[model samples]
Target: MAIKFLFFPFTHMNKSQLKTVLAFFPACHYLSMNRDFKHDPSLQTLFETGKINPIFPLPEPLEKVEQNFGQYLAWARIHKGNKVNLKSLLKDSPYFTDDSDVTAITSQIKGEKSDKEDANADALTKEQSLLQDLLFLKMAHLCDEQNEGIDLALNDLIIGHDTLIASLRGCQSLVSHVKDKKTIARKDLGEMMPGQRIRAWARSLSAMGALEPQGGTPLFITTSEAVFGYLEASCKDLVNALDIHKIKVHENECENKNEWQHLFCTWLMRAVQGDGIRENDMPVVDDRCSLLGQVKLALFSGNGINKIFNCSDKQIPVCLIKLK
Candidate 1:
């Protein structure tokens, strides 16, 4: 007798459909190691009390999820700026805005000039300190909400909610320190602990074509891509969906043709391999190949048009130039 197991790929299914399938695969359920302790108590209570519903709606639409996550990142950036800017503005208003009128007004005040200057300086310092405190509170609140959103997304995915919450909490602490003026060392975004399971879940969602990783540390994004590729290949439908576009190579006609051609060829080869394309099937075009040549020219010509040229729905003019 031989033991056997079945694996069903449900990459294309939306949240509701995925839940239905997971319901039948009870053995596959695994808790995220990074789960938030604060939220975990409530979640466990809900589960124990039979309040865990099988059909809870996802917090946002699939297309909007990545956008929502991007908004969180943007909020993080703005929050950091708000702390620094608010503090600086209070400490030295002239640094942020013109204060010629204030300077003249201060000079006109006659009595107790030295005392007034000291008092003003003290007041400004206090205001800056208060603003810094408020910014930290706002950052903490934003972090909490973001952590909750991550958990909700994980709950939908059926993985990594706990681990994600823990990571978010850690991130919040690090970011809070970064916002404080008294902090001696600058917080390195890249130095944060790598939550491998959360990364995997994010990549899994990306592989399902439900999300896209935007701006982040290069190492994080690279590791995420590796995990995403693995999970994506696990689904036959996703693999098929990805194969619709193929990366090909062609020689470049630049002044440094040899170097450019070599680099382009190597990059194209890697892309093809990464996409699971067979070596023999990789397309090769001539140096004068219209589409490839145009793409190369576009890259050199300007920014913002690199990938747009290759998009399936793109339209380009087919002007004819004749040599005399």
Candidate 2:
């Protein structure tokens, strides 16, 4: 089955209508798979014995850390700054008007002076470690909530909630740690330079009728601000064969998920099978592994499945261009 044919109809669907289509997509696709298996004994045997799985192999079980964000509380403890409190560093206040001032605070938090004076400085003394101790105790309480399984639906919600907050904090710590480090260079997308990426993106967009017909006039394409900036900087002065237009975007108003440029590019790459996309693109569930038990528990508890389909309505942004 060609994915283009399957998903092309979605371009016209509204949100609610689209959900209706998706609700039946899996069951319908599975019926096709079953029909194929029944018609061919070998294929049926492969499916029954799990020699070959359809579309997606079950995803490997979630790692312990992936299963619960509470584990990251321990991670925070392990990577915590050497300074136990920022009160003395900030002169016992929290007001910084400049990057330099903030840098000073972070430097003290990181114990740069202590490291210079003695690399093997002792951990913060208990008396000065009040804030750190309290923070850890709070995290420990969160971990206990998950371990105790207070309520299944509520726990599922907590897992997602904790992951988001913990991830944000973890990212903040990481960025601050490397604030003074040299910037890492962005790698090329496979072998394609920025210009090449733009050209290839144009080709796919045209195939999907995402390109605008300007009749020799320039037509602007829209994309997220990030993608626009990337192309502007990296693809400077690149010539185009198609009737050209500059990329346009509204920084604040643009919804990240609805970025048309990115959404179409993702659909093509995931759904279409050819030299351009995956040759074996199909509707399949990844191996559930140990996480199967967790999902079952959620299901039994009236919590919805957290399974990721091979295809979805809101795809991560791919290309940075869209026809305006």
lDDT of 2 by residue, 1-324 (tens): 222212210111222222322222221111010113465575465457643333311122112212223334443465468465534544565554322243332333333443432442365443223222222222332433343343444445655565567577777565444443323322212222223233323332333233323322112222223333444344313322121133222222233313432443343333212223332332222323111100000000011100111112222112222222
Model 1 lDDT per residue over 1-324, tens place: 111111111111222222322222111211121222345565454345542322211333322333433444554466565777646645776532221233222222211234545566555553333222222222333443455455456554433444456467777564544433221221211122223223323333333333222321111111122233333333222212112123322222333444444454343334423445444543344355332211110001112111211222221111111110
lDDT of each: 0.30, 0.29
Query: Which number leads on TM-score?
Result: 2
TM-score against truth, every candidate: 0.18, 0.19
Candidate 2: which stretches are off by over 4 Å? 1-58, 61-70, 73-223, 235-324
In lDDT terms, which candidate is top?
1
What is the C-alpha local distance difference test score of candidate 2? Answer: 0.29
Q: List ranges where model 1 is wrong by over 4 Å.
A: 1-22, 31-42, 46-324
Alpha-carbon lDDT of model 1: 0.30
TM-score of 2: 0.19
